[model samples]
Target: METLKIIKIGGKIINDTVALQQFIEDLSKLKGLKILVHGGGNLASETSKQLGIKIEKVDGRRLTDQKTLDVVTMVYAGKLNKTIVAALQAKGCNSLGLTGADGNLIQSYKRPVTSIDYGFVGDIIQVNTSLIEILLKEEIVPVFCALTHDKQGQLLNTNADTIASELAVALASSFSVELYYCFEKKGVLSDMTNDNSVIETLDLEAYHTLFQQGKIADGMLPKLDNCFNALNNKVFKVCIGNPKMIVDSNSIYTTLQL
Candidate 1:
């Protein structure tokens, strides 16, 4: 069985073209990696603000109203997706850009917000791995944006981490795939104020403790949740670490053990 690697690149690192290109160059060297999922939330937010748009969030998740959804769709599916595909192509990697809506690769429903509705925000409920399997069998890497689709055939904004987790679950179930969630931060830290306070590894039990103790909050909370979700779904290995440290197994980061 050929091995596949599903990597999700952080939005912050995607902004640096030099770094992004270098990352692709590194990935191209890997023999059988199948897919890469990327996010551009920071860039999208900045662009929205420039266009005089206000971003609303609840519990660290973006509330994608119709207006904000338009901006994000352009940034994630249009600009960022193409940029990544081109970068990988320049590095000699065959890449195809896609979103959840393409072939309904990932199916989702509108996330219900009590008392207020986030127009186009969604919670991913299903992922169709058949399309990815075909692409991988052809040795073509599928680069995914975090955009999903609702049952009504409308595009919906989703968290990139959630998208990656769903994809990881689907791919791992059908193939040998390693899931890596790369971020700008070094890893999950025991103490957010200290860079050296990184937790080297975590298990399902430990993760629950951290969450219950209020140790993980804000952005880190969702990321950790995604990691656990992937692990629970039988992904062989899931790592949360810096993008530059991806090639180094010894580099400090949290590896979620199944």
Candidate 2:
């Protein structure tokens, strides 16, 4: 099986031009099939605030109201998506920016109101793996944004981590997938305040201990879940680290194993 590298980049890197550019440059050098998924919540929230759309979250997941949906759709699918594609293009990577709506690549259902009505927020139901296979076979790098559709003409605000994990899981049968989650922190930290406090190797037991001790919370909580889910579903490798770790073999980063 050929190797596939699925990279999910978020946090400060999404908004910081220098970091994003550096990431694309590194991405251009990666071998075999590659995919890029991005999160631009910081930028989305800023844009929403400027537009007077109230932003809300429940347990690190966004509560996407109608107004917030419009903001995120425009920000995630439009601005951030194209920006990534264009950057990769300049770096000599043939990148194709896509949302779940594009070619029905991902199908999801909206969250039903339970304790919270997450508005247009979606939980992925299916991924069209054949389309991805076609793209990768054609040597077209797919750049995905955090947006999905119901196949009913409604765009939903989906989580980028979820998208990346689902894609990795789906592609596992045909490819040796390496799932990379690049974020602001170098890796899972032993101390939150210390940026250099990287926990290089993390397994489920250690993760549970830290999690129960409340070492991990907020966005990281679900993000870690996604990482484990991918590993369990046969993703060949899962790494959480700074952007440069994607290119640097000896770089300090968190390596997750079951």
Candidate 3:
């Protein structure tokens, strides 16, 4: 099987033009099949504030009420996806910007009401692996935004990290899938205050320990969850780190192993 890399990038990197450009250049150097998934949470929040929409979150997952959902759709599926695709095109990597609604790439339903209602947030149900494979065979990179839809015509906000993980798991049988969660930090940090405190390797036990101790909280929580899910489901490898890890073999990064 050929190797496939699914990279998820978010946080400040998505909003920083220079950093995004650098990431695109690095990603262009990576050989073999690859997919890019991104989140524009910061930009979405900023846009929301500008439009006077209240932002709400519980444990790093946004509560996508109707108006907020509209903003995220525009910022995520519109601006960020196209910008990344245009950059890849400039680098000579033919790319297509997509949402879950596009080509029925992903199908999800609105999260059910539980302890707290998540409104229009989505829980992914399916990934169209055959569609992905066809794009890969055609040498077109798929750039995904954190937006999914119900087949009934409702768009829902989804987490990019989970999207990347699920895509890796879905395609694992056909390829040696490597899932990557890249952001501003070098890697998962032992000390949130210290940028240099990267844990080079993390397994399930260590993740549980840190999570219990509250060392890993907020946004990093869901990301780590997706990492383990990918590993447990047959993904060949999973890494959480700076985007440079894509191009640099020895870059400081956290490797996740089951």
Candidate 4:
């Protein structure tokens, strides 16, 4: 089986033009099949505030009410996806921008209203591995935005990290998949305020300990959940770190092992 790399990038890299450009350039240098899954940083929220819409979140996952959902769709599937695709194109990579709606790439349903109502937020149920495989075989790099849809046509907000993880898991049987969760920090930090405090390798036991101690909370919580889920399902490697580390080996990063 060929090796496939599914990279998820979020944090400040989404809004930083220079950094995003450099990151895409570096990503293009990586050989073999690859997919890019990206998050909407403050773009949705900022756009919301401008339009007089309120943004809400529960556990760092946005509560995608109807109004907020529209904004996210525009920002995530529109401006952001195209920008990344254009950059990758300039670097000589044939990039295909995708919302989970396109080619029926991802199928999901709205998150259940349990203790709290998550509104239009989605819980992904399926990914079309065949479609992704076809694109890869054609040498097309997929650039995915954090937006998925119900096969019935309703668009839903999805988490990019989870998307990357699920995609890796779906492709694992056909390829040796490496799932990467990239962001602004060098890696998962022991001290949130210190950039140098990267935990080089994180295991399931350490992850549980951190969660119990309240060291990992909010957004990091689901991301770690996805990481462990991917590993347990047989992803070859899972990583969290600076985007540049996707190309540069000397760069510091965190590698997750089960």
Q: Candidate 1: global Cα-lDDT?
A: 0.83
Q: Which candidate is the best by lDDT?
A: 3
Give me candidate 1's TM-score against the actual structure: 0.93
Q: Per the 3 Å backbone cut-off, how many clashing residue pairs does candidate 3 have?
A: 0
10 residues in a row with least lDDT, candidate 1: 242-251
Clashing pairs in 4: none
> Which pairs in model 2 have colliding backbones?
none
The estimated TM-scores of all candidates read 0.93, 0.96, 0.96, 0.96
lDDT of 1 by residue, 112-220 (tens): 8687777688889889888788888788999999899975778998888889888888888677767888877778877777878878888878877887888875788
* Each model's Cα RMSD: 1.7, 1.2, 1.3, 1.2
lDDT pick, better of 2 and 3: 3
Name the regions of candidate 2 deviating beyond 4 angstroms.
none
Residue 24 of model 2 has an lDDT of: 87
For model 4, the stretches where C-alpha displacement exceeds 4 angstroms are: none
> Which residue pairs of candidate 1 clash?
none
Can you write out model 4's per-residue Cα lDDT over 1-258, one digit (the tens) per residue? 899999998958989989988888888889999999999999889999999998787766678889999999999999899989998999999999999999999999988888999888788999998989999999999999999999898999988888999999999999999998988888887877788999899999998887788777466778888999999999999999999888988999999988
